[model samples]
Target chain A: MGELRLMKGNEALAEAAVRAGSDGYFGYPITPQSEVIEYLMAEKPFERTGMVVLQAESEVAAINMLYGGGGTGKKVMTSSSSPGISLMQEGLSYMAGAEIPCIVANIVRGGPGLGDIQPAQSDYFQSVKGGGHGDYRLPVLAPASVQEMSDFVPISYDLAFKYRTPVLIVSDGLIGQMMEKVELFDQMPRITDKEINEKYPWATNGKPKGKERRILTSLDLDPHKLEKHNFHLQDKYKQIEANEVRYELIDCDDAEYIIVAYGSSSRISQKAIQLARAEGIKVGILRLITLWPFPKKPIDELVIKGIKGFLAVEMSAGQMVEDVKLTVRERTKVEHFGRYGGVIHSPEEVLEALKTKIIGG
Target chain B: MSEIAIQDIIKPENLVYEKTKLMTDKTLSYCPGCGHGTTHRLIMEVIEELGQENETIGVAPVGCSVLAYEFMNVDMQEAAHGRAPAVATAIKRLWPKKVVFTYQGDGDLAAIGTAETIHACNRGEQIVIVFINNGIYGMTGGQMAPTTLPGMKTATSPYGRDIATMGNPLKITELVAQLPGTYYVTRHSVHTAAAARKAKRAIKKAFQNQLDGKPGLSFVEVVSNCNSGWKMEPVQSNIWMEENMFPYYELGDIKVDGKLLSK
Candidate 1:
């Protein structure tokens, strides 16, 4: 319970993690996401709340550290940018396969390779789908504003623990760098030693009983066992798909056209929605909050309602749009528009696209 | 009165586990010849001997050992493929009194995880590292590994592990011993009873080093064999590992600080 204060999205994310009773943070300082570590370093949450914060050698190490921390059922997380996240793929895959609960925040920058420090949403597919190898999905949350960064951090932690799976808080350079007012939640008291002992009977701290030895590995020499594990993971993924979809609708009740967007791109689309309304154009905005869950229900509802078409605005060339199209099932036309690399589209740019495709103004 | 006293006898079975009896009811999926099973047993022995069954924290890595947390009867953490060192570093640093260790495979420790592993050694993080070197990626269908010897064949290296193309083999035990933070470094194969017994001793000291307050990074390499990946009978694979593998990778404590055992 605190008053609203100006903060960067990444910084708010760090503070939110501490407030969520996170026990450890392992991260490499990459641009855009660098502020996340800077906030942790300056605040020293480890000393106050018994949190372990370390600036790892590389993104690879940071993600691995998260693997270790999450494996033991400790609230652990790591934050990075595009290139750094790519390095964490192996660890992420293992975390998913091992069923270790942890949080990962990717403050995406534009990149096919070494793109730029600027904002880019090209990592949409990577975040929503399995960013790493193997058949699994990391539950991904996309924050539209600085406030959502703080809000989503705790939500991601809760989801990770509840499902006993990994969760991704995926933002872009724009949201990470932009400053906005965020309300800091009251820090919750950490679980006592007694509670941890009773709660995590599955975690291995090392004593062997007649009960089988516990292993946090993803490997199985036996094909039958491996298949069984994969099937279990597939079940979890389906459950997440069924349960976790979320989105925001603006002016859609009277909207003749719907604009689909997410992350930083959604913010720009909000402006387009306002401008179109002023000109008496019944244009609405559908901003996706959970990227992996992909806001399918609201989208399908709109498609069935006979909404003319959607202009998919994203920082990537076109990733989420494909999902939108597939989910819409050819019911409505979905036009794609985006920019790759470090360049982010302006509100005017989105408005221009809307004017041509939706308004004909 | 004539009945046997229930509590008087030193019931080795009675001292079964610890306060944090964090064990999952999951059966192991390791193959008959996989080194993961034996190495895991050796660790349990050390845990039992030290009487730190509950207070100890085990860090599992990304390879075959990733699910180690599920089978070990203790509080466990899972580290990324090679990030076990860093995770162990943080866990130990945050909870200085707790015993922490990392269990990793060759691909996890020597390949992508090398950066974190080396840095953790350099930092002298007071933790134990049980390095399992099976020379191939058993989990990923027998792909090449960092420790895959020159001329060895794997799925990725269809012809053989060509030095010019695949790069030099990684030696973590030797590489880690060079770090000042390292208190003990030893390489032992699990093919024979002799080697497995010696391995138990090496691992025990590694844990003892942490308990003594002289925080150090200890490395214990268990040269294990993967049956499914090698496509050989368990017995034949063990023999092959002894004759061909042991020569290049000699077994013994390369470094130790406490009571000296004659080489």
Candidate 2:
């Protein structure tokens, strides 16, 4: 274990960014996630790690700044809530189109509009699916705990640079505001231009002598060329789907039913599974870690092992259930139970929903 | 006519001027008689004159000149439509020593990216902004621009632009000049040889301000002609622009050294 410290999830994320050697963070203030920028400003990572921290005029400017920094092959990140993330969709599409690498953390609050400043998982569809206009994909990581909030910063950056794709951390108000003991990782030195050039020859750092100028752009005017680029992106997504699906299974073996959940819902489901098992119900929990490349293979294998039903617990009006239903493909019944508009479901509620929807119905 | 030897013409002493090394050999994608070619050449010439090719980073806007990276032999990042200032802001902040500039068109700078343009200038970001005002969208096929003159015909404004409902054209260069953080704000043109020389000087001064580590924004707006979009011969478009556009968008310095030039 590394240094053990009690910190808020948002603070832990900021600390993790510093330790992970992020070169820049540009963000605007939004509820349930304002602590991210607050912590960065207090820490002054600029003096300590030479990281550039800027409070942009809006989420629009913040994300575009990420595009600029990421285009130069620099490790950059931004954090926002639902409404703020909505403003960033345009820049996200551009980054995806240009194949730039950066991390975005969405500390989700309830919304179709500026709903409320409470935890909600409603943004799952927007983040996991393409939120912006275009045929594109980003690895969406759901952190269920304050520790993973800290841990996923570096992991997301690794996955981001590994594939030259944006990686999103799908958190919520609960995880962002809650304080927990976390083992912070050791510092990793910021990546240098030479290292970036070695890995990404397409990075838009200044053109060196004898090297061709590197143009960082997503605009392919010719339809044929654009189509070719789209194909390449699709291939990359397919590979990610094949290799990067991650989840945690608790009491899965010999269980008749499984509860699929993530983030705060995962925490609630853990307790629900305990209560359900005590009531002679053979229930297990499948906690999703990566939501974009939805852990389909494991769920498929679980179904193969004769699991009869799945209960999807969410903080939205059942957004991720569609993905679960698609993966199950009529082999097993999949039901959804959720609390919408900033409301959270408790363990008792989840257990009753499982018995009523999955086990009984 | 007196016969001159080929060798004499090729001699260094006889050569008056040559194209700058800052331009790549790739053919420019601008349409025939388009001002973008002249503007692009002037910028490259400025970069060459200052010897900042290796130390400069250009942010290319999403317009006809989106492929400017192909022509300018320097580091470039193609920004999303109207996001060049935010992009340039980050690049300049990260690498403060690098001379960063954004080349944008009328629709890109004035209409779609108004917020970024204002905030970046307001914040005094040390970057050069080369705004090309053609009064119409060229890449998307002659759509009305925010700078489009009243009663100007465009693909979108078939019956001429109506200021009553369609709104009056926005003068963004004058708008930017109002910001406290701008060190220099000027509007020039590239229609004739004299105008081209003046435009080149403005561009050189803009780049020099960046190299000199000036603490404020430097904006250079070039009132250009879009022959194809304007539905006129290249030469005719120049005549049209000089007659109509120049009067409204007069060539002059709006701000100098963080102070608005007295009218």
Interface RMSD of each: 3.3, 0.9
Worst 10 residues of 2 chain A by lDDT: A203-212
CA deviation > 4 Å runs, candidate 1:
A207-212, A221-225, B1-42, B57-97, B103-108, B132-171, B187-199, B222-254, B258-263
- What DockQ values do the models have? 0.39, 0.78
> What docking class should model 1 receive?
acceptable
Name the best candidate (by DockQ). 2
Q: Please give the clash total of every predicted structure, in order.
A: 37, 0
Assess the local accuracy of residue B76 in candidate 2 as a C-alpha lDDT between 0 and 100: 93
lDDT of 2 by residue, A18-116 (tens): 999999999999999999999999999999999999999999999999999998889999999999999999999999999999999999999889899
Overall local distance difference test of candidate 2: 0.93
Candidate 1, residue A42: Cα displacement in angstroms equals 1.4
Report the C-alpha displacement of residue A167, candidate 1, in angstroms. 1.2
Candidate 2 has a DockQ of 0.78
Count steric clashes of candidate 1: 37
TM-score of chain B of each: 0.88, 0.97
lDDT of 2 by residue, B1-263 (tens): 99988887798777798888888899989999999989999999998788877778899998899999889989899998899999999988888887899999999999889999999999999999999999999999999999999999999999999999899999989988998889999999998999999999999988888888887999999999999999999999999999999999989889987789887
lDDT per residue (tens digit) for residues B40-66 in model 1: 877877876887775788887777767
